[model samples]
Target chain A: MENIHLENIDFEYAPGRRIFSGAAVDINQGELVLLCGKTGSGKSTLLRLIQKELDTKAGFVMQNPDNQIVCDRVYSELEFGATNATQGNERHRLELIRQRVAETAGYFGISRQINRDTHTLSGGEKQILNIASAMAANPKVLLMDEPTSMLDPIMADRVIDLVKNINRELGITVIIAEHRSDRIFAYADKILLIEDETVVCKDKRSMAEYMSRSQELRGFLPEIARSVEMSPPPLSLAEAVFGKAHAVYVGKEAPLSSHPVLRLKNVSFAYDRSKGALIDNLNLSVDGGSITALLGENGCGKSTLALLSAGALKPYSGSVKINGRKIKKAGENSAMLFQDVTLHFTGDTVDGKYNGMHPYDLSGGERQLAALDIILSKNPSLLILDEPTKGLDYNEKEKLGKRLEKLRDEGKAILLITHDVEFAAMFSDRMLLMFGGKIVCDRPAREFCESNIFYTTAGARLSKMNSD
Target chain B: MRRFENFNPATLLIYYMTVIIPIMVFMNPFIILTALAAGLVRAGIYERKIPVKRILFSAVLTAVMALVNGLLSHQGDTELFFINDRAVTLEAIRYGAVNGLMLAAAIVWFSAFSRTLTGEKIMALLWHLPKLALLISMIMRLIPRYLERYNKTGLAARINEERGQVPEKKHIMQITSAVFTWALENSMDTADSMIMRGYTSGGKRISGIQFRPGDAAVLALTAALQTMYFLPETWHGILMAVLCFLPEIYRIKENVKWKIYTLKI
Candidate 1:
């Protein structure tokens, strides 16, 4: 194993806009490194330089799965990296390439999807394909630019697992850029944080040592690690928050509305006829002045229900009443914020929020906030947000929770669909679970967190352990 | 997958090239009718249902072409009637009808061509041109995605509607600009990703287009039939026309016996 040692690296896009100045780091082979920074802190640029994709041998996996996929089919995408490595014999090249692609695809657990069209894959599958393609290249070093930034919690975990497997099983040096470090920090052997226009490199053993002095860096730590006051924080989140006291919310609960803003009665929907109805004879209602979270696993009809409630998709056989009126189409009084924030940003500059910078140039969290602002400007009675805190850091998620609280106080009916157990428990007043197209459980937020095991929050877990 | 989707691209291209030329060039009503029938038969076998609207549209176009020729061209000897000081000749109308039928037949055959040859199949045939193959497949994937995004943007606009009414002009403009920006940004990211994956690596990659024994047989059949098509005769041309539909006929028969011979996997 050979380590890549970068000494005094300097990079800049233009004059006066310094990205990295005299940045130096040594990345040992077969080690997992986490790169953390603010959105514009040149995290992607640093990764790009490390990969040297335009001029070197390092593999790169992009943040957006849809944008990263170049080939039309999965098999072709898997073959892309192995086929393009210019250093192979002409003899038996095709046979060698085929075997390499098949092996990588199988290892990535996407063997069945090889023949499937790349565009037809789900968000998570596409990200896995991106990583699989990178692995297919078989490079000594792999640089990922927030690979799990756009994935749901469940999907994000799968990507993290694959990355860990690549680091351990393949013994490839893995460097990942991520904003939310809760899931990834545990796997990282070292931490590379960009601050003060320099790369601060710390091994896993000394990361806590450094964090104790750098209060600003401590905020980037996982929720569990930030809460604990140990001199050297625990290695994993489970250790950091074990037997610790948890914060408790005791706000006076706002009463449910007498007249629901959005109502569904006997609603049933299915994308395909052969698959049967995913949402069958379901009844749900959302009223003003409270946040109601719709929680479920991936592909459990949460998004479909969100779409149906927003009137973007009409149920096959059911009544969707908005403000006590049966609507033929998506009502103007209802607004839906899609999971992809970029889908909603149209203005040049966050509408004077960013002093005329392009909306595309905004950070992920800023872009989400800007998009939500645009939707809110429409003054809709009911707001449906899908996975709002999916890839946001702890701070951004807290900011988002505050924004939701503000909206709820303004008497807006909020439907928050998310897989983040902690975020839902923090902000939502009521919780509902949609399993196999039916509302299996509906309870108050705190009560739901107390009862459920897997769907409960980190704070709940800590409190449970403390009690035990 | 369709019956001919997995057929070797080179063989499929050869078959289409051989069949389309006769449809385009030969003006005889029998040849044109047979070509049209063969195209429809093959497409029906592939799709399992004939596209009635497309066929009807072609018929309407043929009728319009014949009528236009009867009204516009007065060069023929046999006159049907005089309209606006111009002779509506029967010969001109018949000539126009045959020409129109030729055009329609060519269209139907080309539709069959498109059905048999996907962009990936084209890429497979041009495997040596890796960059071009990638571009073609990327475009093929991007188009449907662009349309889907466009529709979703429209949905977003509807969601921003006021009092159950669709958005005003300002909202529509916002939606359009947003979608355009997203498209542009997405394209740049896609290009970067492609480069990272070695799209511009200045070397060729092997396509996943395996040529089996059935493909070899089809290639041989196409080669033999193409020679017959180029021959200056009516019988050989007619034989080639029937051969054009051979794959579809074989497909139906093969499907019937598929379970008996092939394992379920």
Candidate 2:
């Protein structure tokens, strides 16, 4: 059964500024579709078009989990859609709505937070609530735009798993647009590629093959699919084990510098006096001419450590020294770039090229680079970035990686806090995993990734399984 | 307390009105004292601890109001003292004290009312007016989100200032403008989400609270007790006390019933 059919759909933001032209897609019932494109490539616009085309009820979940939520409390948000759909305030109808809310909450494992304030939930929990609320209406189709783009790896995986479960178990058609396709690609029954005012829909295997042939779109493929050299490339790590292992390049370790750029000596910090220290006696050093990646779970002190090293936060006991000089204030010797790049902008124009344009007018990747430019103007020897790859596409990440490498070559120590293992492996010279308020593992990026089990990238895991 | 909170929002709304309206309308000293006592006890029970700071603040505020009124108005017969060549009479002081006590009682009752009728309950009560209820809900959700954005933007602006960018006093204006732009942009997405979820379907809202027989009983009792204010001053105070402490009495009854039931088990 055809759940959604879009034929020769035309869309444009303004005259001659077209997003999609002669674009068509046919999605069947119970099928999970993946939408992939570059930043500002009309992924969200395409999802909105699909929503508009559907005559039946369709649930829509967008990025930025905070905005989509309309109710103050979790239970209210869950039943918001159903209450808005039902015609009257009849007792039986209200009871049915309550039952649907309860069932959706239980299915999504959000029953524990059923009474919590929607604003109090974490980004991941908020996104889950959005999904549950959308599902509460009992819609025939669900459309999510970059659902996991703002989440950590664990939370992102949990959301993707729930999405997959909703598609498989509930028999509802799911169409999701995501930049982080590595986690969701394998479960997609059909892949929709949007580029240059056109939409190409193909089955998963054919999409993999098609992506492999297109150099620009190849980055959209899963790491396992990209690593395997097969007729129809394997979509998952388990299937890639049967294929031949590709030769992986591990970069040579850089020589340690005697004078480190950013040094944290026995740092211990806690936000609350009653609670344990978030960063307890943690020591780390990032040398000039090297990029260091700090990997950890959300709230495991990666960002706190970055702030400490940047002098934005003071440790309780230890000293943070930039170039062997103790720093007393934030942005004194180190430049820190926050996750939201918009925070870094104070005016309309960042530079001559982006003159007369609002900072928000720029794309996500460009805004990040522009923020980096503003921060770099300080000429600080140490640069600290928190979640730099949060909402960027592959191309943007690549651009950011090259820019970081250039900064490293200029003898600026770069400290990157990210959950993207793939970006860390591909760019950072050193990898440090923080757990339990301490750095548990510190080594060269490739060596560190190759040795770890769960923390490693899909390519590393695939190679490890093949070698096994 | 939980059982009291579980009553239908309509019943709770009516209960609050009946309990508060009489105290507001009748400025009798006995009625004021009874309402104040009940409000303190209810607030204490709901919060799990006596709000000593709130009590102290209210006491200081009432004393200041009484002192100001007594000093400014010297129309009474019995003069306690002369302040700025004007007599401060005992009758004037008493009148001021009563007015202050009335204001204080109203504050306490309203505080208790706010604590009992949370945002959810308020929305539930306003379900008959779906648009207003939704607007209230959206405001409750967005105000916090907007403040968060403002704080984040302020922090970012400070970060920029630390990096050799000397923003003037207009920094606040800059932050506000940025946040406004961000809100406007994100509101589009929120509106799209609302449209997708059938927000334009003109359907009535249905709150999750169920109106049971116990709620009806409480509503009837509240109505009956509130009407006793028309009887006499003494009866008004007595009935008002009963109406105000209804939740506490019900809680004790339920506790005793549970104890006996558990003993039988």
What TM-score does chain A of each model score against the native chain A?
A: 0.91, 0.96
For A76-161, candidate 2 gives per-residue lDDT tens digits of 88788777656544888878887888888888899999889889999999999999889888888999998988888788889999
Q: In model 1, how large is the Cα lDDT of residue B229?
A: 44
Error of 1 at A427 (Å): 2.0
Q: Distance from true position, residue A405, model 1, in Å?
A: 2.2
- Top lDDT prediction, candidate number: 2
A1-468 in candidate 1: lDDT tens per residue? 658787787888998888987867887889899988766788888888876733335678888889888778898888777787635666577777888888898788999998899889999999999888877876787888888878887788788888888889889888898866777777788898888788888876587567657766775776566655665666564674553545344222443554578899999999999999999999998878889999998888999998888787889999888888787667557888988777766556767577767888777778788888888887988999989987777667887889999999898999999987778877888888889999998888877876777887655656666666
What DockQ, on C-alphas, does every prediction get? 0.46, 0.56
Interface RMSD values, listed in order for every candidate: 2.3, 1.8
lDDT string for model 2 (B156-206, tens) is: 655445534445657778888888888887898788778788877565676
